[model samples]
Target: MLKKNLLAIALLLCISSVFGQEMRNCGTMEVDARLLTEDPGYALNQAQIEEFTQTYKSSETGATRTVITIPVVVHIVYNNASENISDAAVLSQIEILNEDFRKLNSDAGSVPALFSGVAADVEIEFCLASVDPDGNPTTGITRTSTSKTSFSTTDLMKYNTYGHAAWDRDSYLNMWSCDLSSGLLGYAQFPGGPAATDGVVIDYNYFGGPAYAASPFNLGRSATHEVGHWLNLRHIWGDASCGTDYVSDTPTHNTANYGCPNYPHYSTCSGSPVEMTMNYMDYTDDACMYMFSDGQKDRMQALFAPGGSRESLLSSEGCGGGVAPTCDVPGSTSTTGITETEATLNWGSVAGSVGYNVRGRQVGTATWTEGYTTGTSINFTGLIADTDYEWQVQTDCGGGDLSAYISSILFTTSGGAATCTDIQEPNSSTGTAGTISTGVTYNALIANSSDVDFYKFTTTSPNTKIRVTMTSLPADYDMQLLNQKGKKKGTSQNGGTSDESIVWNVNSSGTRYVYVYGYGGAYDVADCYELIVEVSNSSWRTDGSELLVERVLDNAIVNIFPNPASNTMQVNYFSVQETEITLNVYDLLGNQVQTLHSQVVQGENLIKVDVNTMAAGLYIVEISNGKSSYTEKFMVE
Candidate 1:
């Protein structure tokens, strides 16, 4: 049995020689120096931290020392199966860190009598994060597969390009493990650097204990040393001859010592005192390095103190003990009561929902005309004739925890005539104003006493003078022509709709809107009234005293489509007479791509521009009447 055991040990050593690194090399100082040249602010921030460390005093032991538990997020960026380590390996690393920092390791007794009195427990612990930044549950280990074989000290492993992005650095200790460049075991970013690259890194080959790691550098001490640098601990020799490590109790050393050194190893600096080669921050082999001095403990704990650099970490809920987040989407949705101008939507309620947010739009449009409601069903009116529409419902669970919007429900409206019944039934608000072309007569009914109609139109320079005629009357109705802002510019209140009209003049040409409603709840459900909007150069004149009109309109008669060609997104423009207009299409970068000079008839003009040749993005359609320009943007995807 003894001969067999010896052969097994020899076999293990041979395998380790293939993958193990014989010497430890940390790149923390090199990375810091490179960043100091790249960013001046990083240098200034580091200087302030050094200034604080030089002035602010820390104590090793007291009732004031509180054990700090830091939440940790481990990003495993790997190129192959071997580099993608298991969760067990990560848990082992966490266990080793806790044992070493608390001075609870089984090998703590190996410290020499001369240094045992000064050996200290740093009073710091770490935990795999239980909650993610999005308030969702997490396993704390993020695994990402990469195409690159290895990463270097440039921090490519800490970003989403080749690896995983860091969690909120202020709330979690971000650690990345990957295949490092040859001979580079690990590195750490010190405090007071850019948050994007702030973290510690380790090679996957040296990430865990003996069960999964190689020899010489195995046992996870590589992380212990790098983490020390993350918390502001420097090399024992300070990376220079007879240099200071900013700690008071550590004996001054001439240079770094490698492997296991015999005790009473004398330094050539000052009185040539015995060096503490067993310190975790030294270059000694893993089995030879163990304890931290009391001075080092105080410096590590300073990060959690008030006004300290990492003080905000104490309030992080990433480790648990907070209200759990809960929100869910709607269930079992259906549409009913379809009509040319009306419809209804219904859905089942989700648990924990106090209310719901609902919105609807034409199938190709981007904006949703909606609001919040406590009811499970919503009635929609002022819908376009023979058009497809989509709407969504979301559950609101209070405390700002809102669920995802449920899948959209689609429905198409039935086609109908424009007479007798109010085709634009729901244009009750300015936000839902219906489109009306100049000189086109519309016959719509007054459904009830509270029914109102709003109509909008676009006019050109020759058509700046406006004339709206409302001849047939069902009740005493009123009309108000307003600017695009819904401000009333003119009104005509001829008693009993005795052929009411509004004629005025303006210096400019653009879109204008009008509102029509009954006076004091008057209506005739069966009769339809005729209304029309017209403009000319010299027909009607205004005295600047009053206004007149006798018609009504409903919700929007336009659509916005994020597609190559949708309902073609009609652009409305009118002139007092027949004329030619120039239309141009330009990309978002201000480069013109298409132009067309077309003749617009005296009545309604429908122009469709083909965008199948363009790539997916946003574009602007401009219409110029040789006097003024009207522009609207559309998307193709």
Candidate 2:
């Protein structure tokens, strides 16, 4: 009995250590365990999946002869603006999935030569759903504003009350991208599970392209890993010591490996087999994990066989080509050469159409002004500055018949002014500087083409780590950290409207400067950005930790209950020290609707605000001490 207890304790320790690393932590096993305990029928379902796997492997004709395409729907639930990722990000994830599953990824050649022969194409494809379950045209992406700060495996985020609910699981692969608490990169549900909760959950930061993707997990491989689990592949280590992953091709691993390990990593398990750290099922960093083995591909294909758990998806018309009759809809529609007052819209030529008609309108307005173009593109000028406009293109097939207008694409015009008076100038070096410290966020803007904002910061002690993040922007911006001698220590220049961030752990204390500038000399007076510079002795945490910073109002505890309130809303907060607090609310259009000032004690306080008259929409609740401020989102219904 004593020996058995010791072994169990050791096993628990091993599992805990594996999860403690800064790597992908999938919760499928835990969710499955919970389901098995609550629903006895789930065991029978899992057993059926296993039986199908075995039978399919033994049958010669069971191998997938043709490619299988899976339809996908992405549900983005966000509390703040940044969490509501862009459509381009979601499309980038789909592109990554297709490349990796078909062995078309550029990194496929990086797979170690020893494992290259067994690297399977898997013959699988993924596409965003063009038609929703209601038989209506859709983009397959749903956005929901939630009061919940973070989601866990309880699947509360899967419901409409808390967030956007899943689509029909039998016909679509439901993917929820939100702020997952803890350091979890993502999680997945295996083939045999309740339909209501059948899907995958990915951390918003790890779901998309490199613009917002963090290091180590930024390659959009988290979804690839989670999807592998959803298709019935287990962890490379089998989640146990020397245990089988049920796939015969992969070598036995003692445990999950974190970061990028050196090649030929030999496991301590029996035979001292060299671990396949490059396998997608392993816990290595995204850039390190690349290929799937033949055995694992067979396992996924088994689920699509007749009478299998996911066989219904084979008949799903969600892939767009089969369900809808062939019509020349505009493709690759995009905008370029955008300025404060004009934009150039472009698209690929539609076959059968001689010319196209373009229409533009403000997003919330009803009227669209139409223009005709003989070529594939058109230019719209005389647009208002600092406003969002939606535009669409219709194919003119000839004889007065025009195809229906494609879905509207949105773009926001830049602020007209090239400069602002509020921001301090000439802070580009330590000599002319605005003082900054750790744990405080500063808001500023680049006023014009020549505008550059800089701040000089000092560390009180040695071996301090600092992280700088630039967000809430109006244009593409980049940042750099320089030492006292003007040598660049780090730089971040993410493209497009994505946020820029940089981290540096200095070994010695000294003066440093941060230089912020607009990309390609672009700047706007009306659009301000926030810079968060955090200095700590401890190592920097994951992106989730940075999100927590957005939650708190600088050392104050604030909570708003019953969000999406129909009547009165209660605001509760704790003042760490005596401070004057101001509360304000704003709408999506940046209009301030309500404001209140309060003198608070050092402890807890509650204030009720009447929101009955407010319209049903998203609102930002901002609480600020005299020195610092924080904001959260709440919905009024």
Candidate 3:
């Protein structure tokens, strides 16, 4: 080692003259300071990482190292054609990174003999991501046109409102190439920071193409330097005079060197050691700085330790291990153009799809009628009215790669002219829930093909057993039961126009809500379906079954008990859905009597009224919901 240092002194003696040039500067620290000031979470993240790295680097020695490949996505935010660099420029930058990190560059041998002993091959490689976050094939490049002439450390280019939002940071290393504001080569966010702005930003002019690269910074070392910061390597100068760069092997520098200063220019701190100006973390020109020290490599590798923030990157399938990834399945299916005989099925498009396999079958049947279409939609014909059917789609990715089918979507063809008007208005959400009386079979519309109905009904002691049943098929419908606290109690999703029902044996007696809606945007304007919220003191299995309860399916009245009652005589009456009803007693002369009961009901109901203040004569009971009326006779003797 003394001999190598003496050899370094010999190289130092060889260069006597020096010249001044524009010093290369990076904005990484400036951005880090800003984020630390503005975002508290970012500061905490940095603190935690710093603590871990401190302990890890000091305690761990000679640990086995493995080659870790990171997937990269280059985002091009440009204003003019000049800023929109070609694919070759981006690829060249990646090549430079591979060369520098893996010690595969042609200049590896050119490293000074003094520091060559501590130079490290970082065992890290980067590949352009093959699969995007959405599981679609990609070139690992994204180009966006922006109005801004140039971006600065403010990072306006990293957002969609200004330029383009970042891809998921956990999956890929994001690099933005743009015309930077005035004078800046590049900057990078450290390992621990917010995901939105987490990446390296490079000047479009210096983005590593030999044809367009400017002098001194042309060899693409700017990206290598910035990515080093991104991987948690401080500048070799530590941004201080003879400050610690956290790597023990590297020599402390007086300050940032410019124009590739001659070696052996010693800092006045501690050992007055010869500055390692050729290190990539130093401020040397691109062609001059080429090596990472063993300590620096260990520092960067610590970020991928068991509890590291970048650990998730180890599991990313973005490269698919050099194999072509599987095709993405179809998403979010919809049905339209419905009739008694046919309807249209549509879904989102899949990337690189050669065709889509569409399949449909009647509900409760196994046989599916499959068809093919190159477009995103297909027409289903020869259908039956009021029949329940389900369909699914799979993407044909070509090359014998087919994706699995998406979940089946349900629909029912309209046929019967069950024209009914909407009853409950403004009952769209829980906040505007309308009151529903138990045992009343309410008829309401899904109206305008997109209505969601919410209703609240109260239960009583021993009668807390609630069963909500939706009948008279209008479209694909679903029902859900919620407790007073808005927690889901039970849900019934029997797809298609088939009757949907949910039975809940609730123990408590409070207001429970019933949410009814057409599945998959299914609704009708002029058709109304029957919804019955039945409450009974009857027993239920709690394992998904219900016993019987007394409810008048058909409207009826009378069956007056006692024969000759005095006060508060039982006047049994039946009614369904929101309605008004009345009961009256008349003498033998047919004179009018007092009205017994008159109110609106939400579902099937049975009411008792008093006949006490009536004369000993015959009387009549009547019930009506304005749509229909029922009556019977008895004596108030």
Candidate 4:
């Protein structure tokens, strides 16, 4: 018996080693799938979540224009001293989140112009909770020491019995940083899941500043990506072959993209479209992925809309103000002459200020090396190459009390050499136009902020719809559509790392021109934008019948009602033809509690389920026609 037990343990260890070797792994899907199999109620909750999201997206009044601030509580579960990350590292992650979500990251300029128009300022902010759950002042960070060297999706790290328990999840976004057993970087529970474990779990090594974080995954993007899932965003690839991530703006990816990929990496899926490797939802390295699409922002913002799963966080006091300050906030900060090891930082001169206290540090480092500058500009030296750094300025008002430090700005040192080669010139007008077709993709560098590129194409037939898209790198680029006479027919000029797109349907078969220019004359030699012009003759209609067809194909119009039921629940379903169906109920552990075999005729069918004797927790109801399946979740009272 002892020998057999030893053999079993060895085999388990071997299996873990094999599965944990991947460089990047997210346990969200695994955990979610387990929940769907065990807890029958999770299905209904997810359906309601989808319905709420759809309602918010369709209602003009439900649009979330204002910024929503979420209170964050970081729980550090460390087995050793080094695992207890520093406050500076924690602060750096918070700052990075603020920048990335608001489209203020220093690398925002690197997004290709083709995708920049869809990039969004999520208008969401995160701040450390100033008060604990007990109404006491807190730093919004907690630490717990454990004997376990590692953890997995069993959530041992989330409970106080083993490591740390979450705070009030409804009022705070709980983030637990720990040493995960596998190579898993992180995972998050989507909205509508159990509240006790409702938050994001990040591997401690991948959670914070550079001093402790590992390379390739070190820029604090792991938390950014996981938080995205917590806010209801799915993988850009939809976690399946040619899957739909449910966001229209993001291009369909066949699978995850790891590391940094060159621009215009074409997908092998239908249409052979170019992949968006830089999207945060992809599996790329931290420094590689930078932007989120507008559609993704809409989905995230829906959680804060009224009647949404996370709406309660809207009233949280986690970010309540502190004591008033005497000094004014600094403004108008800028960086210039950036190189591999040096950068020049400048800020607006503050009134009543005698001297400025400047502090700078490599991103993810704990301590800020300080410098005193009497003038408006200061030159920083001894910086690392291709590294991200942040600096802040404070006013010294002569007395002992100095003004508060203003918001920090981020800058990245130049990479030693550039590998870009797609440089094009003399394509600014019809005479010098670069010939392009509907299906082919072209690449070019703006060279500088002042540079612009032009291309010309001829329509083969009347009633053709032309689409011109430009994606830029490290700068904002805009596009304009012009007729053969050089008259501007349409333009798209979204700000930040968003892409620019211009579509025009013409009745006449003639030559047309496309003008691509940088926004605010911004450009970079190392980064290039991709341009794809697609011309199609298909009739363009405004009616939304196409979208309806897509929905019906995805699901057979199944509905469940009287959720949080006390006695009975109704399942109403529609099918085009008569089919045999099976209904099953599951618990949270993925165990089948009950099953019913039934048949449905063409059109609508109603089936009633009695839940009076069921347990008072979440349950899942899964209906299958042997060909397809639909699941919903509900609660028993």
RMSD of each: 26.8, 17.1, 27.2, 26.0
Please give, for residues 325-394, the per-residue lDDT of candidate 1 as tens digits: 4688788899999998778989998888889999988653335789788879899789876666778888
Most accurate candidate by lDDT: 2
Worst 10 residues of 3 by lDDT: 2-11
lDDT of 4 by residue, 184-299 (tens): 88888888887668899999888875666887788888999999999998888766545556677877777777767889888777777788889888888888989988888888
lDDT of 2 by residue, 1-637 (tens): 0010000001111132354456567676766655543343564566567667877877833354689999999999999998899999999999999999999989999988888888989988999999876455889899999988888766767766457666778889999999987677788888877777889999898988687687778888999999998998888886655655767788888878878999989998777888999998888889898899988898898888888789899999776754442446789989999898899999999888879889988643435789998898899898867767778898888887666677668898876764334455668665787877777877777766678888888887886877677777777678888888767777775443456666675657888888888765556666678887878786443221222211234455555666656798777665668778888887534567899998888866777888989876556677778766555556666
Off by over 4 Å in 1: 1-21, 58-63, 326-637
- Please give each candidate's TM-score: 0.50, 0.49, 0.50, 0.51
After superposition, candidate 3 runs with Cα above 4 Å error: 1-20, 321-637
The superposed Cα distance between candidate 2 and the true structure at residue 497, in angstroms, equals 47
Error of 1 at 264 (Å): 1.7
TM-score-superior candidate, 3 or 4: 4
Candidate 4 — which residues are off by over 4 angstroms?
A: 1-22, 61-64, 321-637
